[model samples]
Target: MAHFNKAFQFKTRSIIVLLTVFGFQLTAQNWDVPADKKAKNSYIKFDKTTASEGEGIYTKNCASCHGNPSKGNVLKSLKPTPPDLASSGTQKLTDGELFYILNTGRGLMPSFKDVLSESDRWKVIAYVRSFNKSYVQVLSNTDPTKSDKVKVTMVYNHETNTVRVQVVAKEQNTSLPLKDAEVLLFAKRYFGKLPIEKGLKTDESGVANFVYPKDLPGNKLGEVELLVKVNDEVYGEVESSTKLKIGIPTDKPGLTQQRAIWGVLAKAPYWIIALYLLGIATFGVFVLYLVKNLFDFWKKGQQ
Candidate 1:
């Protein structure tokens, strides 16, 4: 009787522990999303438009591999079955993880880095989560409606050695400044790694400024390909073929002048002119020495 009671107590404790763990996992999964489920009085709004847009995007782009979301045909063919979007697996993933998978692609899924814009990718992810309760819960937790509408502008100036970046939030038909939006600027060079620069948020006008180094070692100032991102979403990118002319340092004016003079001299017959002057100077010195020797011999004979 005692042994049976001990075994029963052990089993009960084990069951409790398992239940607690499962509950924790569920809560954790739920917490990974933004906290706006009903779209009522929310900062970020989601509706049929976004979901339809996402469905269209997915059909055009993702359906080739993932298959029809409703049927899960293509997904089933894989060795390990792809998680059904309409099932519990969809809710099991965090919004960030889903975004990462959609954008970066894992295993057989191809990366959509070039194919989809960051915002569109997020929208599709939001749509995929709408299929099930778990996904809906996750989306509700990771609300896209909370995103501040931001406008981004990129300006590259070769003369000033600067890449001026601007970001603004659009609210109520008026543009308000977004302060402290992290800006990442990168310029790809021909021969080496891209130079990266980071800038802080704007003041009243929502502008961030990053100056390109006056002299990027081993890189000529020429057309540089640039990539810019704000809040992890790509803002805008531009490839400028602007040339950055080499500037002489203030302390090296003499060297600059010497270089200028030598450049002009190089264009002319400098070697021939130098040789001719050297020959004339040699002849003049020889003639003076010979005349002095002759005068000295005459004086000695007189003595």
Candidate 2:
């Protein structure tokens, strides 16, 4: 009986230790997302209607901290304030990462999984991305099969430093060169589409040429998405995206390039600051001198 009790105690202690360890591990995990969730592709496509809807939802739910520039955040005074979602750092994150962040809020951000429908959350991201040009999303019909039906090919020429985009229209499970199709090469900018020139019709080869400049700015990863679109009246509009290494990141601003709404004395040049202080002091002295002269004139009038 004593042996039996000893065995029972050992088993209970083992279970307790294991449970304790497991709990510690959970606490230490930092709320990391699983690999599968991080790899998920978003079902939502960018469209004006969806974005507008997203804007509304964002204004209602998120604008207090992350929506408008002037009033984007009411929670700015929170202990861990929400970041400006439109900034370069937040814009560089992949769609999946953003989606996960939205799905599971961290720190000061509350999880919208309870408050917002999943689809509405995605719209909010679309609206937030709109503030910056590079994060500009491509609009397409939500029908997955349509995007799959069209094929787009893009090639970069190292010698000429140009991009060649070929778009083929698919019909009846056959490949055909879509000639004279209205094609536009869109370089994703912060706020809107920057057409690579004027919109051009594809030639007999269904190919359009873009002079990719080496100096063109990209995201923090030194990459740019060249969005190729073929708008067909009957066949329906189709689009494809290709990533290019365009070198320097344009999203990040330089010291000299930053615009300050509210200025601080520390940011001013030493000489400029000295002159400003001197000017203020001189103005104060002049005011005092005028006040003294007025007092003397009043006393003389009284005499």
Candidate 3:
């Protein structure tokens, strides 16, 4: 009886531990978004027009998993699965809080600070909040705090085959340079932007240098768009872009790409080609035989 009691106690403890872990996982997702000290209420008013504009941004950047507005369906294969932004799980977050999340993504979500321009991200927030109709008027009435935006210039050096980046943060009201800001560089690819080099902090002169690939793969035209961005830990994000000429696209298929299952007809196995030819020949013969039989029947009727 004692041995059975000991086993029962062990099983009970195991079940309790499992339940605790499961409960924690469920609870954590609710408050998983980190606080953004820079986050503040949006000044931009929410309206059907603003939300419609935001819908364009959201569909392109967010709809893959969250749910496509066009299709009205979402991908559910992810482990935790992306939440429906229109639902209470996301609608409950304030406009500022939602903006912060878009700026700084958590877990499987990606930060759109660099992917999207500052105004576009705000536009997306407007579209998302439109799902709840209560805050439309309140958002328009609230005053917004203005923050300093950054300006970045990129010059590609042909002699050294490197990119020279200059980042200057200045208040929109005052054009004077703000020093010691962090800047990031990104090269646009077919699917998305690929970040190159570590984030650099500007010097006293507000200049930072980076080495970009001299032969980065690109489209058939060999053009790669380079982006320089700065996301302030305290303020808003700003960015600039310049197109650079890179190496030609590497999409030209090799000889190895010419064979097997999905290969061109010329690259197909001789036997398969022969079978294809035989099928055509057999079809031709079948038609000819039927024609011959019909002619013979006509002749016999005439006789």
Clashes of each: 8, 10, 0
Answer with 2 or 3, whichever has the higher lDDT.
3
Candidate 3: segments with Cα more than 4 A from true spot: 26-28, 32-39, 68-72, 137-303
Model 1 per-residue lDDT tens digits across residues 86-178: 556665566665655665565566788779886687667657766755334322232244344656677766678677777776677987665
lDDT of 3 by residue, 94-204 (tens): 766777778787767788888997668878888878777565433333222333355677787777777777766466576544355567899976467889888877677
Tell me the deviation in Å of residue 137 in model 3: 5.7
Between candidates 1 and 2, which one is better according to TM-score?
A: 1
- TM-score of each prediction: 0.43, 0.34, 0.45
Q: Where's the lowest-lDDT run of ten residues in candidate 2?
A: 254-263
> Distance from true position, residue 30, model 1, in Å?
17
True-vs-predicted CA distance for residue 75, candidate 2, Å = 2.8
Question: Which candidate number has the best lDDT?
Answer: 3
Residue pairs with clashing backbones, model 1: 33-141, 33-142, 34-140, 34-141, 34-142, 34-143, 44-145, 180-201
RMSD of each candidate relative to the true structure: 21.8, 24.6, 9.4
Q: Total clashes, candidate 1?
A: 8
Q: What is candidate 3's TM-score against the reference?
A: 0.45
